[model samples]
Each structure stands twice: as C-alpha cells, then as structure tokens.
Target: MVSTVEVPEADAQFWRDWGDPLLVSIVDATLRANHDIRIALSRYEQSRALTHQAGLDRYPTLDVSGDVSDRRVSASQAFGLSRAHRDGELHTANLSVIWELDFFGRVRRSVESQRADTEAHAADLAGVQVAVVAEVTDAYFRLLGLQRRLQVARDNESNQADTLRLITALFQEGRGTSFDTERVRTQLAFTRSRIPPLEAEAAVTANRIAVLTGREPAAVVTMLDRSAALPVYPAQINAGVPSELLRRRPDIAAAERRLAAATARIGVATADLFPRFTLGGLVGTQALGFNTLFQRDSETRVVSLGVGGSFLDVGRVRSRIAAANSAAAESLAAYEQTVLIAMEETEDALVRLSHAQAEKAILEQAAEASRSAALTARQQFEGGMVGVLEVLDVERSRLDVENLLAQSATQQATALVAVYKTLAGGWPQLIPEPQGDAMAQR
Candidate 1:
C-alpha cells in the first residue's frame, strides 16, 4: 500500500507486470549482453583495480637489484694494477624495502577517494542496465505500434483505392465529377505514402531491440516475426512519492557516490599540506669475488627514515585543495540536480499515465463513429443517394482517427516504460558468466 507518509517500494521487476514473457526475456538478455552494460562493467572493474592500487601505498614495497662487472687495466693505466687486480669481477646484490609513513593520513584519504570512485562506477553500471532495459522496451512497443499503423495505412489505402475505382466508374457514367476522382486519387496516394516511413521505422526499431539483446538484426526480426498486440493494463499503477523515486534511481545513486568521492578527495588534497614520511631499509650482500658472495663478512644492512615537506610550495598545495573543494561543490550540485530531474521525469510519466486511458477511450470512440460513418456513406453512394465526395470525406476521417488511436496506444506503452525507468528502485543483478571464447574473439 502506497501512502503519503511512506513511499511504497517500487517492484524491482515492475516491467514484468506487462505479462509478456518475450519482454522479460528481452530485458534479461539485454542486461546480460548489451554492449553498454559490458562497458560499464569494465569501467567498474577498472575502478576496483585503481582502488586496490591506491591501497597498496599502505604497505611496504620490496625491490631486488644486482649487478656484475669485469675490469681490465691497460699498461698506461697500470698504476692502478699494483693496487688492484688487472682483471677483476665484482658482484653486488641488494634487496630494498620502502613504506610510506602516512602521519598526515594522505594515503588513507587517497584510498578512501578511490574506494568511493569504485562505488560510483558500480552505481553507474546499474544505471546503464536500467537505461538499456527501458530503451529496449520502448523500442519494442514503438515497433509494434508502427507495425499496427502500417497495417492500418495499407488497409485504408486499399479501401480508398476501391473508392477511387468507384468514382472513376461514376464519372465515366456521367454520375460524378472529375474532382471526385481526383480527390479520391489524392487520398489513396497520401495513405500509400504513410507506409514506407512506417516500415522503415519499424525495421530500425527491431534492429535496435536486437542490438540491445546482443543479437543480429536478422535474428531478432525472425524472432519477432509473429504478430503481437499491445499489452493492456486492467488498472492504473500507483506512482509513489518523489523521495522514494529519487532514493532508488541508479543515476541518483551514482551521483551521490561521486559526491562522496569528491568529498574524500578534499581530504586527500588537504593532507598534501603536511610533511611526507617513509620508512626504508636495505638488506643485502656485496663481495669483491663470487667466492665471497653471501659470506658473513660480506653482509650489508641499511635502515633509513625520510621526511619531505613543501613549505615553499604551499601555494601549489593550496591550489590543489581549492580545486578539490570546487569539485566537491560541483558534485553536490549535480547530485541535487539529478534528484530534481528524476522527480520531474517521474512526474511527467505519471501525468501521462493518468491521462492515457481517458485519451485512448476518446480516440477509440471517435474511430468507431468515423468507421460507422464511412460505411454508411459508402452505402449511400452505392444506392445513388449520396455523392463520391461525401464518401471520400468519411473515409479520410476514419483513417485519421484510427491512425491517431494507434499513436495514442504507443504513447501509453512508452510512458509506462518511462515510469519504470525513472522510479527504478532496484533491479536484480543479472550478469551472466563471461563467455571466454566469445570474449577472446572480441
């Protein structure tokens, strides 16, 4: 039960209410294979790796280095040969470690920023899934509407063609004017013109749906070849409160996460004002000959404490802090704006949904009346009680109303998709296992 005090939770699988198994499958497949989803997922993975990299600063780093050299002294330079061997091999090896001592918490702040960024990317991935599902569903409904309208246009054109033929016969029989024939011819041609564009759009929409589902356009067309009517809702769905709509939308979540990352960055920049410290050590062995390598007398050890600060470069540090603050401010504004936009979209969708049924009913009644009038006018024309002009007028009216009705139906379906997208509370995670062979090919 939705209420004023508490916003009802939107169904995560709200689109399923259309009761279309095909739609469910298409949405699921799109979530699984859509290119945008894959890209977002990859980005999320990159952020996670970056976060891990940032965290690595908290631990010691180890490095191993070694070098060997051979020396030969010329006669002219033999003054060194008396003190050192003419031919010699020298070997050195060392293992070194360095660890940042984050007394000012710079490393911690950096890691915090990266972690928040990772979360933002995760939300971005979810947002992409929401958008892809909505887009596919919208295209599917539009395709069905276009197909219906195409059929209506063709059917109307045939009827008008028959009318033109009748008018031509009447004119030949001295019972109709040339204007009557021309008028009927014009209407027939106009109706025929609507066909090509509708067919083109329908084809494009089908291809869009196929692309969303990660399939070839031809395959999608084949799968959708079977005729389908628009799904009808028996009753209106409730539009929950604005607060809940904002809370659940993935875009809002993403924006909020980014804001958090920006805030963390401010801390990171502020930490730059303090001194940096590190703990470093070296443990190794150096020998004049291979035989002395690793001997107790050849062992070496080193320990160091390093401190670095930028008291003279305070301007640069201050500038960086200012930039981070600005970024956080921008993020906060963006988050707020996103909330407003989400609310606006949800309101628009709800408004359309509210008026959808009434508008549909009105057009349906008008279509019925125009259809009846056209039939009556045709009968009167055949019975010699009416002229071709009246019959043509009625046919035009009938076609206009029906075409409008088809468009209205499509709007209703698309509006519902908008509502679900705008109010996207949550959705099931549907990432499938990566197909290794397919991925390798890509």
Candidate 2:
C-alpha cells in the first residue's frame, strides 16, 4: 500500500522555511536548551567516546614504568644478602608494548559495533530534536487559538451587555417586561463566564512553551503576553511519499541504526567463541647505580606470542551469541514498528489537515451567516418584529461558530507542525556538540 503512495524529497527542510520566525526561533532555542535534547546529545558524545576507545584497541599499546628507591641496610643483613654493608640507591626503567592480532576479527567487529552504536545515538539525538520542536510549535498554536477564543467570548460578552442595557432601559420605560431584562442579563453572565477559563488555558499553553524553551513559566507568560494573530499556513503541503519515512523520520532512522548495531554485536559475540591471539614485548634496563640506568650491560628484553580461548565456558559464549541474536531480532522488530508508526502519524496528520481546512471553510461561512442573522434579529427586535430571546440566541450561535472557527484554525496549524515533525523537517545535518557549546555557537 505504501508503495503506491506519492513520494517527494522527504528529507527537505519545510518548517524552517515556512514557519513563523517567532515560532522557528522558539523551536531553535528549545533544541539548544531543552534538557531532553541535551541529554540525547550527551549520550551521542558518550557513544562517540566509546567508539574511539574501541578503535584504540586496534593499535599497539605502549607503556612506561620506572621506580627509584633509597634504602639503608644493617651490617649483618647486608653481609648475608650481598656481602656489603652500606646505604644504596637503586633505579629501574622499562618500556613495554602489547599488540593483539586481529586474526579472528574480534577487534574489527567490536569497533564496528561501537561505530554503529554511535550512529544510533546520533539518530536518537535527532529524534529528540524533532520531538522538542514539534512540542513547542503545538503549544504555540494552541495558545494562540485559546487567546482568539477568549477574544471572541469577550466580544460576545460586550455585544450581549449592550443588548442587556437596551432591554433594561425598555423595561424601565414600560416598553419591555422584567423577564426579558433578566434573561438578557443571564445570557450576558454566561458569555462572561467563558473568559476566565479560556484565559487560564491560554496561559497554561504559554507556560508549556516556556518550559519547552527552558525558561521560567512566568517569564514565558510575560514574554508571550502580547496578543498575536494566529499564524498563516501555506495552502498546500508537500508531504513526500510513504517510503520516504524510512529516511526522513528520526525514530525510524534511530531504530534502524540500533538494529544495525545489534547485528554488529552478534558478530562481536560470535568472535568470542574463537581463539584470541596477542603479541607482547618488553625492553628495559635496571641498574644498582643511577648513572648506569641506561647502560647496555644492564639491559633486559622479553618477547612472547600468546593464544587463548574459552575451552570450559563454551556454553557461556554460545549463550551470549544467542542473546545478541535475540537483541538483533528485537531491534529489527522495533525498526519495523517505528516505520509503521511514522507512516501512521504522517497519514493521520495529512487527514487532520485536510479535515481542518474543510471544517474551517464551513465554520467561516457559518460564522458569517450567524453574524448576519444576529444583526437581522437585533434589528427585528428593535422594531417589535422579534423577541429579545431570538436576538440573544442568534448572537450566541455566532459566538459559538466563531470560537469553533478559531479552534479549527489552530488545529490546522498544529496539524501542519505534526506533518513537518513526522517528516523530520527542520533539524540540520549531524554536528554533535554539547548543549552549552551548541548554544554558545548560536
């Protein structure tokens, strides 16, 4: 089914180019400051260090040893040991080298496994980057939506208040009944009630964005205090094909890299079942006199080639191999699952975006019609052609539809973010650095 899907350049950067500058800046800041992303980057560094350490095993190892000591001996003890009684200084130095031959390819396989592990960690970091950006973008859009809803509610409240005043004036003048005045007041109160909760919800969403950006919640609330309009999105989204998900989605890439690492580890484990070979040598000189420490006559040399294997614990080695194979199998399954999830999320986002656009269009028309109806009803009521309740009902319906319109716009924006996230849209190429360092660079 995926094979039949239209594919584009899935790895392209859509969000950075298309998103609002403020939102893009927020996402960039979050990527650099968000603790989760920092943690993943740290893990990537650790993996790189491990890989380098593993590669070091491929080269010969060398070390230097030296010792200097002074001792005073008693006359009887000195005579018994060396036929001399005196205070003496002794010095010794040694340089040793050990190189393990990769006859069974253990070192190579281990290095390969570590390299794959490092790549897996890099992919993990990318996945975290994608997640943080998406989270911040979603929060931003939601906050804007709530703010717009609050504005609509307030506008409705004001309109209803004006109606209540007119109705109260009419009742006082003996032109309207007390029941109509009370009903208008009640309607105004209900409309006013929606404001506080919407404001609170908007504030919470702002706090979420602030936290995502690694700032204090109150500080974020202050920063985002200025009312802003909802962002505009491009009419058409270019979502690449389904198969592009394998390369574009970080979770899929991470899962695949982990699978590769697991496969490499199986080879590493298998290498343990074979004989290990090493060659070690030491060349050093020791002398009783410090001046003669480097003299040829004091030179000592040793060299050896060694081979060892686990003869008794064969079952343990096989068990490890079996475990590695099992892990590889699990990673493979995880990779498949990741691919499916990426595809599902992308498809869902596409569907949501399409529906939100359609709904927004319909709601826009409904809101306009309601506004016209409310105006007509108000005019009719003033002329004694309609009751106050009829005007109130139409105004309330207009408010409801306008609120839905605002929410639908938010949904469309959020769905766009989801699509970009599912496509792994914004992150740059791999240049792993510490969080502090990355931020400093920015």
Candidate 2 residue-wise lDDT, 204-268, digit = tens: 88888988988888766876776567755655666656765577776787788789889988987
Q: How well does candidate 1 match the true structure in TM-score terms?
A: 0.85
lDDT of 1 by residue, 74-98 (tens): 7577764563567777788999999
Q: Which stretches of candidate 2 lie over 4 Å from their true place?
A: 1-19, 70-89, 426-442
Note the residue pairs that clash in candidate 2: 7-241, 8-241
Per model, state how many residue pairs clash: 0, 2
